[model samples]
Target: MATTKSSSYHHGDLRHAVLTAALEVIATEGPGALSLRDLARRAGVSHAAPAHHFKDRTGLLTAIAAEGFDLLADALADAPDLRERGVRYVRFGVEHPAHFQVMFLPDLLRGDDAALLAARARAGGELRAGVTGMPEGGRGDDARLAGIAAWSLAHGFATLLLSENLREPVGERDPEEIFRALAELLF
Candidate 1:
C-alpha cells in the first residue's frame, strides 16, 4: 500500500513523506532525476509543498546529505575494530546507495549548511576513530593518512560492488565477507 496525498498528515509528516519519496526517486532513477515537483506528486502533495519545506533543490539535498551522514555515523558506531568499521562502511554504502550517492557529491548540496557540516564532521570523526593504531598523544599526520587510506579502500570497494564492476571477481560471495578478507589484508 502506498501513502497517497489524500492521506491525513500531521505537522511534520509531510516533510518526512517528501524526503522518503525523494530517496525512492534517487534509488530508482538516480539523483539527477530528482525534482521537487515529482516528489510532491509522489507524496500526494501540491507541487509547491516541497519548496515550502526545503526552499530549493539544494536545501533538499543538504538535508539528505546530513541525514545520510548521521545514519552512517550510527552504522559505524558499534564496530569494534578498524576492520569491522570498514565492513560496516561498505555495508552502509550497499544498503543506502541513494544516500551514499548524494552524501558525497558536494556540487549537489549546500556545503555551508551548519547541520550538514556538523553531521559530516561527526561521520569523519567516526572514520578517524576507527584507525585504532594511532599513537597516544594526538592523531598525527600518519593517523590522518591512515584514516584516509582506510576510508578510500572501503568507499572504493563499495562503489565498485554497487556498480557491479567487480561482479566477475566477487561472484556468489557476500560483499561483507569479501570486505572482511580485504580488510584483513590491508588493516
Candidate 2:
C-alpha cells in the first residue's frame, strides 16, 4: 500500500521534510539529480505530496534559491567589516553548497518571482554596500567595478573551495582562514 500524502511522514511538516530531502540530494548529487518523486521518496511522503508544496522541479529550485538569498543577505548584513562580509559570503557558499550552486544559475529559476527578485536584490544591495567606497578606478564607475571585483573574488574562491579544487593548494586549511590570508592582500 502507498502512503497517503497527509499521513506518509510522521511529522506534519511535509514541506520541510521534502525540502530537506531535496537539499540532501542536491548536496550529494547536484541539482541536476533533483526530482519531485525522489524527494517524496526521501521524505517518506506520498508521490503527490511534493507537488502540493512545490508545483514542479522549477518550483522546488526557486524556493531554495529564494531562501538561500535571504540567508546570504542575513549573513552579509551581520558582518562587521569588508573582510568579514567576504568571509561570510564564502562561509554561506560552503555551508549551503546546494543553494549556492542553484542561486547563480539563473536558468534553473523563475527570474520574475517576486520573492526571488526581492531576495536577490537584498543580497546584491548588501554586497554593493560593501564596495560603494572602494578605491578601484573604473572611469567613473568605481563602485560598480568594485562590486563586480569583490563578488568575483569571493564567489570564485568559494566555488573553487566547494568543488574541492583547493584541497591541494589549501592543504586542509579552514576555508575562512585561507580566505582571510588571501583577503589581507587585497582588502
> After superposing candidate 2, which stretches have Cα over 4 Å from the reference?
1-11, 133-141
The RMSD (Cα, Å) of candidate 2 is 3.4
Model 1 C-alpha lDDT per residue in residues 1-187, reported as the tens digit of each score: 2358766244457888888888888888999998998888877778898898799889998999999999999999967878888899999998999899999999999999998999999998888888854454433557767788889999999999888899999999888999999977766
lDDT of 1 at 118: 98
lDDT of 2 at 13: 75
Q: Write the per-residue lDDT of candidate 2 for residues 22-124, one digit (tens) a residue.
A: 7888888999999999888776776897999889999999999999999999989957666778899999998999889999989999999899999999999
* Clashes by residue pair, model 2: none
The lowest-lDDT stretch of 10 consecutive residues in candidate 1 is: 132-141
Best by TM-score: 1
- Taken over the whole model, the C-alpha lDDT of each candidate is 0.86, 0.84
lDDT of 1: 0.86
Q: Each model's number of backbone clashes?
A: 1, 0
